[model samples]
Target: MESTTTKPDEAATEKPVVTRRLDRVFLELYNVAAFVSRFFKEVLMPPYEGKEIIRQFFEVGYKSLGLISLTGFITGIVFTNQSRPSLAEFGATSWLPSLIAIAIVRALAPLVTALIASGKVGSNIGAELGSMKVTEQIDAMEVSATNPYKFLVVSRVLATTFAIPTLTMYTIFVAMVGAFINVNANEATSFPAFIEQFFGAITYLDVFSSVIKSFVFGFTIGMVGCYKGYHSSKGTEGVGKAANSSVVTSMFLVFIEELLALQIVAALRAV
Candidate 1:
């Protein structure tokens, strides 16, 4: 054959990668929504698995403590040191301890811990479920008359809901201790005074708003991780993709939820 000359229309006819991404996004969103709804339905039904749920509780809660605390400690110290000089330079140094402590308690501690845990827990959930999906284990469970969603997905969602807030609280405590160390580095704020401001800034509004936002964040992250893993289809590459997408999606959802939560809290306060 002679030269196959491309026409102008043919040259311009490449499939839009952006369109494919949007399609994938919608498909995944639909699947995850269905999975979450199934989770609630399975959860409310009787004949629950106490042992599995307990194991999930331990896995999600206890296993996360070390990383959360370590991160929290560093967060506290660094945030304190970083935020101090400017305030000091402006003669607002006395506000440092309480201000930093409040920031830790109400926002930074929970959000940052969630960010780190999203990388850890979300990736693990995705990889683990992806492996199961690839190995046909999830399918086998279905064939055996088992509700895998109840056993695997719902339990994790529940565990994350309960665990993250407590984990965040512990993170906040340790972060304050780090802040205390930082405060004493170049200034003379007492620990007790710092504690006072911490509690004083903590209105019920702040406490409830922060805790609720984190719980929602945890639920979104855990469910998204498991959902991605459970449905992974690209074999080995799917596992990696799931883990990466879970973290990225959960982070975006967390920020979105933060804006939504702030709006809801403000509305509630106005009532």
Candidate 2:
């Protein structure tokens, strides 16, 4: 008796694992671009959902303030405490206020705010939309001659797009306050002096860059969350997956935006 060896089917292994993953990534990117384009189209052609947008503003902005404020304060304190030793070694400890201001305004505030919003607002949008999707509430809206995408998706996306920038500015202020507390404790720096130094260090370019970065981050968070939720499947399990995906995708995009923003700003400054 002779034993026969069987060869694996070529068709079954036509695509390698890496190739399949790359395909999936490109497909996902295409879907995201399409989703974002649709959002822009609907937003411009709307009998705008004013009331819903306001309600979402309250939900996304106001409800998140307490948490954002706490996080900002803690971050400022920790960063200042960490920087003091390095500055002292160079006899430049007096630069603490200016340094904190630049750091917070240029990078820290926007990044921190975006990350927090991604975790909080992103997940909320994803879960809420996903639930509606899976429960057929979205379909029901269509049956009743309602535009669910406008009522739900547009409002929430707009809310996040606008709310996050406001939150970032607030975080900058609160973080400065926290930094001042540390500075005052160490050097007895007056509040007015700290404020003056902070503003003196921050230029119009810095503020502009920060606002632009925040807006980009906000759009990323909202768009990613909406896309994940709107496309979610697999029933209730998909809701959880959408929420998790929203946070992770938002964070990844935010970091990418931050790096790009920095490069652009640096290039402008060099000019």
Candidate 3:
């Protein structure tokens, strides 16, 4: 005869696993919220790390230009290639530029740019800081009274926050260029005509909303990277883990933020 009954200790341990996980999740949420709060507080009350921020701006923004532009160009061609055929069937091919413009400005550019930044900028920040934390550089900076958090976290976050909007704007512009080239190649629309219609289709609200979304996405990317890096442990393995976590977490948060932003934009449009 076989006994199938579970032991009391085993049951106790099994029962607490889910509960413990939930507790850990809540604890993490609280910590992240606190981290963001401190960023805001310190950002305002500071001997502004202007030079560091500028350096990060170059590192995060200018360095990313080529990748972002290439992505935008490819996206433009693909989206138009897929969309134009369907639109042409409806005799609505004339609406391609506006439609693409709206779609790009409203969603595609923001999501793509954020995701790219998550992989590139987020991982870079996480790895750099994780390595610093591992090598005890952060501790040494603190002992030297250099305010490592400001020099590292604040500068990178602010640079990302400001840089994303500029990147987003550039993405849209380059994407439009690709779209125009496709349209000219396929449908023979003049560049000037495409440009006129593209700008015409864009509204103040669209620009404003897109910029706002970029700021939030950028902040999320920077915060997750900084947070993961700042708390990383277990040495070399920890640095890899932090960088991986930064990209995954930033991407997850970006999607969540996108959904929320859509809802907010819809509500505003309704009003």
Candidate 4:
């Protein structure tokens, strides 16, 4: 009968495999923290890459406008349509504008905008940087006395950080417009009345919290994309992986941040 005991070599190798994986996980976390710290450091002390940042802004924001607009409009219409029956059942149809406004302004707008940006902008940054990494272009930039990190990572990150909030504001406006269309059709609610209810339902705190959440979400998306792409390996395969992982990671982080932000906002509101 074969021995039931594990061979010494097999046992030794098994332990190391588990240990190595654990070590790799922690090492990856450490590297990410360092990368984030470096970004804050370099971003503040800069021969600022103004042109690159502007170019990235155009890439991230302007190019994404059509998709964002369409998504926001659709979301508003769908949400309003879905909400109407519930309100109507209670004879509270008049509250549709305020309900939509609060729901969109306080939650839906920021979340939808961030998720869209995470897919579009995050994947683009990851693919772009991953390609640069694999092609040795980044190395060449370093050899040519350029700070590649500043020129590439910082600029893209800054672009996302700023562009996303602006996009969120646009999303809110577009979504509100869409919701108004649905409301108008159902109740003949005047646009002016809808607009008044929309603004009246939202407070300074709601706006402030949404903006803060957008900023955090933007930063998380940008940083995750940059980190994944910057450290990518294995040539073209790695570039694809980087882009895919950037989207996945950014979306995950956005959800986590959203949850945390809501908790913090709740706490603040309670005060």
Native RMSD of candidate 1 (Å)? 5.5
How far in Å is the alpha carbon of 123 misplaced in model 1? 0.4
Q: What TM-score does structure 1 among the candidates reach?
A: 0.88
Taken over the whole model, the C-alpha lDDT of each candidate is 0.83, 0.93, 0.92, 0.93
The per-prediction tally of clashing pairs is 0, 0, 0, 0
- All candidates' TM-scores? 0.88, 0.92, 0.93, 0.94
lDDT of 1 at 196: 86
* Residue clash pairs of candidate 4: none
Where's the lowest-lDDT run of ten residues in candidate 3? 6-15
Q: Which portions of model 4 miss their true places by more than 4 Å?
A: 1-15
**Between the candidate structures 1 and 3, which one is better when assessed by TM-score?**
3
Which candidate ranks first by TM-score, i.e. highest? 4
lDDT over C-alpha atoms for residue 42 of model 4: 99
The true-versus-predicted C-alpha distance at residue 56 of model 3, in Å, is 0.4
Q: Write the per-residue lDDT of candidate 2 for residues 193-270, one digit (tens) a residue.
A: 999999999999999999988988988898888889999996999999999999998999999999999999999999
The parts of candidate 2 lying over 4 Å away from their true place are 1-23
Q: How much is the lDDT of residue 213 in candidate 2?
A: 89
Query: Which candidate would rank higher by TM-score, 3 or 4?
Result: 4
Q: List the residue pairs that clash in candidate 2.
A: none
